[model samples]
Target chain A: MSAPTEIAIHHVDAGRMGFFTDTTVCIGCKACEVACKQWNDLPADGSQFTRGGSYDHTGELSAATWRHVRFVEIAENGGHLPQLPAGNEVDVDAAVAAMENWVFMSDVCKHCTNAGCLDACPTGALIRTEFDTVVLQPDVCNGCGYCVPACPFGVVDRDPRDGRAAKCTLCYDRLQDGLEPACAKACPTDSIQFGPYEELVRTAERRVSELRRRGIEGAYLYGAGDATGEQLAGGLGAFFLLTEPPERYGLPARAESPVQENVVPATAAAVAAGVLAAAGATAAFALARGRR
Target chain B: MSERDATPALGTRGEPASWARAGADVALQRTRWGDAAWSFLFGRDTGYAAAEAQPGEVAEANRRMRSGPLPDPVEGPFVKAPVWTWEVPLYFWFGGVAAGSSFVGLACDAAGDGRSAAVARKVALAAVLPCPPLLIVDLGRPARFLNMLRIFKPRSPMNTGAWALVAFSALGAGAVAADVAGRPRMARAAGAANAAIGGYLGSYTGILLAATAVPVWARSRLFLGPIFVSTATASGAAACRLALVAAGVPAGHPTRTALGNLETGAMLCELGLAQLNQRRLGRAARPLHEGRAGRLFRAAEWMVGAGLALRLVRRPLGPRVHHLASTLYLAGGLAFRYAWIEAGKASARDDEAVALMGRGAVTRGDALRRPGEARRLASAARRPRHNGRVGAAYAETVRRVSLVVERALRP
Candidate 1:
């Protein structure tokens, strides 16, 4: 897909830039998360060790926690992963054998082509940056919170301290300075790559084919092509290379902007119904008066 | 019979005294903040430290807290819950009332009933008075509420709705002023203008809710607007009727009778549309039928039903029955608004419903596709199926209902 027209209108000769997160290479070390938090100066949410003995304690992405590492443990038997034994004596080999795969995905905002949050914002708080990335202007936001539910990925949220919506800007400031995002810079495995949109898509396509040739049949590009049901409104600025279903990574298989479908029909129906009902009421009143 | 002897002497200093002393000791221990603070600071083995001292027990509790079935990542609450509180729905109800009353006032003027028209105009103005403050108070930054008018973005229903409300309020006030000044022609023109704006004011709140990622609201997009407008009409007519009664209008006044008929028709339409929308939503409508929202919806339905019944019997009971029916309609209209907003909140939290909607499973026929786009995508075998079984079933039901209604209307 071509870069959105808003990009050309807003910035002269600026190309669209985005992230390509290859989950297949993710190490789950969470360096990206730490770097994101550090660079953004986000407040710590305190330590929370998840119940399943999984190392992913920082839960889903929120206002403060932009980049999140999700841990999915799949079982070889197509059932739940066996819980760790309560006794001190544990069979490590058997437990390991029972697991089919343990996948880690670093999740962030999609910066959709047809962004729901941007369309839903009443105040001009959310804007498309020169690099075609969606950015929220915190100062202009009246904190109406329409953008919260408008997000299809459940990414943007209201900061409790201030009540203004917050999400990843895809590092707009860093992009302007010719520097990579902190998450991409800190990723040790090169899992999170940042560059021009076209180049990244080509690289992702080659990697997917290479992975398939290497017998990893599940390797595919999400949010880049129409093949995956996960194609969002047009496509995502930030997309992923995955080895499992999109849902396994807490992503929708398909998404649409409510604005395109719902607004016009609803408004038309309302106006039509209102006019018809008013006419009927007026007729009833007029007839009753005439009969008087 | 021997209670006095069997109860023993009151306050006798024996085993009872020892028990009382033990109780007092325990209460003193509980109330001693200084001792608790000292134990907390120094890690002393006071009785207060017992719970923290047992690491094994604490660990077990933590384990239990975390231990449960693993969450299904696919069944996601895909969007954040709406931040709107009570004020938003209250504003919607008041706005509807104002909008509906303005229309009724215009209708009364068209019918040449100037007395009732003047009263309706005043009622519309009063109803609109609370709307702005209610909307502003619900904003996260109340001080910057005027920022809503900063840009006129037609793409956003909220921005347009805000502008409509401002215009409606101004016209309503002007119409009321003209009525007081005995300028009937000017009042009629102003009231007509207000009613024109009211058409949007009464129903745009529904569009506002529908134009969101919330599953239930978006799925019912076709019907929410009509439902809300019908409720607004019912409540507005009811309010005008009550105002006329209070103004010492005769029970047999043609205007009063006409309003009763209008209110009844609107209430019936509101009830029918709500049911049809719920049926179409299927599993996604769970929020509307199950919880605090469900109870409110049930209450609203019953209130409307009772009002309809009262309307049917009002001929025998005289105009006093009109008062009760009108009150019921007003209350039901308010409750309907609250229930709908509450249901939208709950639907946003339903991960499975949201995910299914995203997958084009629940909201099947409501695909956001251009003409023949679905066919083209289907030919390529890339598009998600948008005509699923549930959608077909809902379509069949709608078809059947329309047929029945058509046959009933035919001579």
Candidate 2:
């Protein structure tokens, strides 16, 4: 009874499960990050040194770092601080006067409605779980990195430690045990919620409205619905509620469902090119025949 | 212990030392972040006080450190996703050449040029024979390669491509065998089917790249297929030309000229389409024209031009000139595939390219406060150079030249 653009041939048994990460409430505790690794048995990306950037110590999502908490500090004085002027020239006094605004978001896989990784897999390695979340079968993945580039959000990655494609599995094992995901369970603020996809969307919508009512400008649900607002990647299975545009959170403004947008045109272009080449050869043969 | 007890707390069961170390490390991290954040707050990297009118924009230094579209604070560059390496592009090159050979063989057979057709068939077989092994190499094991067939996902281009490669290789080999065995009718039918299969084999590679979400490849989706087809046809004709002349088709012979002319025309098409693809992509095409990949692509273009010049303008009527042209064309074709594939990889690493998806061109309108701030904030990144008026003039000149070449040497 569900409509997805990728595969209609197969029938799935279970209801779709997803996450609704509300960035507004994230407290930058790194609990979800710690929880995801503990559950997934992933390693720390590396020893944390002075990154000297934002509050972000662990740089990004990778095979080792399954979950990432992004800390975007938007200063009211644009992004300038008084001590540090543009480039190497520093104005220490001016930097101190710069205004800072913090937006914390715990990032994870979208588990897209039309997954590019699954569609691009040549070896049938990436598969949708019974819970309707995309999961990787390690035994089948042959280290081919097609899925890495295929992801619109750039989530799935090849583990440099082990040459296999890997990403968040939406805690498929825990789902089997009738439990919620690790990240959601660890969220102290309940910013990251886990439940049935439909129920979460309803709750998320009300939460956005409540936030807007409280004078939170641009507090909207991304991938909510095609009719309401942005329905990127045919609507992210793991959607978000953001105060800023998607780009600020490193999410694509219009996450493409490549299976439909990129693939269809590619197929049509290939067919047309093939026909042109064939016709060119035929005309040559016809000319040769005429001479004979 | 039950499953509840068996599962680690918070999904992890790190050693107590590591946990303690993690906690201590976070404290250390906090100290460092605190210092940096303080420095940042004081206009450390902020350019001007007036520019700070907006709320979210960061100082130029912070943007420089981590400049991608995503909110990721630490990951500096763009997506460093490299799923396909040398094997995939090499596979595409070989597969396209094989398909092109089939086209040549079919045309020869239709025209009663049995000797050339036989050579073409052998060339087709030789070109395609390595495809299966190459694919196996990419997949890491033979069983993994075979696993692609387990599902007939017409919805997935990668699956369809796997099947198409197998079909083309099998039919090409069969046609070659039939011709060798003196089974005229069998060879003719197989060769005909091989020709049909070749069309898919020649052009499917472009679709494979285009269908992906990589900004550079995806943006040029409309033209890459045609570009690949043109390259395939030229390379196939060049291969046949080399084989035929080696077997003693004289330099001045109509067949040599005809094949050379076809190669020239197809290379011209490939060149124009590549430019068209680049122009259409705007800033997203920077990776295709900028680094090692860019160097290789420009080299390929020059080689194509060089091949055409050698055949058309060079003096001395010898098979050597034609042979050199064939060699240049072949080299150019290989370079095209390799460079295109490499460029696709590099393009994925571009955070700006990723951010520019759906909304191409990092313009002033993106953020009114800065009014073309991305350029000032990101001078470290290589800028894509465009020459629209001159490019149009050049395109027109190319069209006129191609027409002249085609008319002067029609098959």
Candidate 3:
């Protein structure tokens, strides 16, 4: 597999560093989640046990929770396990086999090549770090909350306590000190790998091919190369290798910066239409007055 | 002032001695001021009570996200809901009115109707007065509101819109000042400048909403701008006409008649564009057609329709019809802003809508990968380096255009 060429484009010295989360090896321990919260000093959002009957207690990534572990239980019939009949006697071994494949994916900020939050931030608070990862400067953010909705992944959120938007900083402070992100460092199984963007992409590709060769046909790289058809606009700096579809991990299959297609055209059309309408109305008034 | 008068003597005259006590029972019995001070110093509830007190819909949505059964992969909110509150839509409405009225003032000035122009300018100034405060108050940190002006970011609609609002307000104020200072030429020039900025101010709000990941807003990107501008025009003209009439302008006056015609025309355009946008959005537009947002949109439609009907029967209804129609148009305009913003919030929560949008993008991507198109994309992706000359030329062109625009916009 050829290495991805777009690397160290932002800052030559540090190189573009990112995560390659391989769900195949993830143990669903959520040590990454704990380490992230502890490192970032992010307050716990809530403690309600999810009704999904999964071990996922932290619902999803929020302003407080940066790393979320998703659990997808697949039945032997290639569907979710059905609720068993209350009175029916079931075979334990058969039941266990039916629910054998349980997928656990630890999700974090994709840190896209073209980040939506960075593009949408009016306050210049969200910036690209030397590692080519997006980071929000809480001090600079005036709590406009535009970044919250702008993030296609729904990663950035407004901290209710402080009113400023918060998200994974890709451990920018740690990277500056020559260390990996808290999540990747804490990951026990090396499922969450952090390194140069190009190296990670190559590693992810090789792993996916290896998995497929070993009869894991569903294994594929997402946001790396063209594995999932068209790439996310500018592609994601942090990519993933997943056995299931991207949506199974609460990730969009296709994402684009709204600025790329929506903002400029919409602004131009609006301004043009406004000018035309205003001019037309003025002309009508001018003509009416002149006639009078 | 004497120290005795400046400082209140604790436990003196009518004051109770218990107020100074540190005991819990004494603290409870203290005056409201003492209680407030105690709470201010020691309260653990310093966190945002407002965040905790979310509206029922939002609370319910949060509850579902927390405790509901796992959503189908393709059918749950994939984006965070907007944190904007009542202040945002209110700001949009006021900003629209300011923009709209400035346009009317410019139109009146162009038509040589000085009285009507002066009234419209004043209306514009009055409308713009509350915009800054509303916007600042809505910010997560009101003190950091100045951060919006700390940079020039054209990529962000919110940033550019802020700059436009500042310029619009300044020019609107200048126009009003020129009118007061008996400088008709200056007033006319300032009014024209304000109207130019106003055109942007009216439309940028729409762009701001559309340029997000929200399904309904993004899907209707093309129409939101025009829809907002049209509503702004209708409302601005309506405000001007009402003011002109109240100032004793005859119903038959050319300015009054022109404004009336303009209001009706803009209202018609707004209604048409909204309908077209809703149609184009398809399933993504469900938020605009259901729940609280839907109700507001329907009310706006009814009000606009009624206003138009009133305009049509003005000959029979007399000048009273003008007042009624103008009022309806203003109310309808406000409703449009609120409805659109509310709809956007709802749309962000609709996972199915966003999932469908993502699916649509994937389908388009698939279509593009057909044989020759795939090769083009692959080659583009494989290109080792960006062509520097083309990049420099593009940058130069952009720089030159912005310089020209800046020069033209300068007052």
- Residue B324, candidate 1: Cα error in Å is 1.4
What DockQ results do all the predictions give, each relative to the true complex?
0.17, 0.17, 0.19
Per-residue lDDT tens digits for candidate 2, residues B1-411, read 011232333432311111112322323233211222222222222111222112221112122222234433212233545666688888888887888888888877777777778888888888888888887767533333445664556656777877888887788778878887899779888888988878888887787777676878777777888898989988998898888877887666555555676777788889888876676666777888799899999899889888988877667666577788889999999999999888988888777677766343442222332212121111112222233566545534543453344335434
Task: Report every candidate's CA lDDT.
Answer: 0.74, 0.67, 0.73
lDDT of 3 by residue, B1-411 (tens): 011121222333211112222334432333311221222212122211112211232222212222222335442338888899888888888888888888888888777788888999999999999999999878776666777776667778999999999998899889899999999899989988889999999999889888888888887777889999998898888888888888999868898888888889999999988887777667787898899999999999999999999988878768898899999999999888889888988988887777756655322332333322211112114323343676546534543453344335435
| Model 3, runs deviating above 4 Å | A1-12, A50-55, A74-101, A227-229, B1-75, B361-411
Clashes of each: 1, 37, 1
Give the per-residue lDDT of model 1 (tens digit) for B68-116: 3223544243677888999998898888888888889989988888889
Candidate 3 CAPRI assessment class: incorrect
lDDT of 3 by residue, A1-292 (tens): 2233322234455667778887877788889999998877666666544424443557878877899887666423345543443444445676456445677788888888767888788877777766767888765677888888888889998866556777898887666555577888788777787777876666666665555555766666667655233566466778777766555666665677765557876887899988987897798698678778
Query: What is the alpha-carbon interface RMSD for each candidate?
Result: 20.8, 14.6, 17.5
Worst 10 residues of 2 chain B by lDDT: B371-380
Model 2 regions lying over 4 Å from their true place: A1-13, A48-52, A75-77, A80-100, A225-229, A285-292, B1-80, B140-143, B314-317, B360-411
Give the C-alpha lDDT of model 2.
Answer: 0.67
DockQ pick, better of 2 and 3: 3
Per candidate, native contacts kept equal 0.42, 0.30, 0.43
The positional error of residue A271 in candidate 1, measured at the CA in angstroms, is 1.5
**Cα displacement (Å) at residue A130, model 3:** 0.9
- Residue-level lDDT tens digits of model 2 in A82-189: 232234454555433432366778888888766777777776667766566787765556566667777777788886435567789898766655567889878877
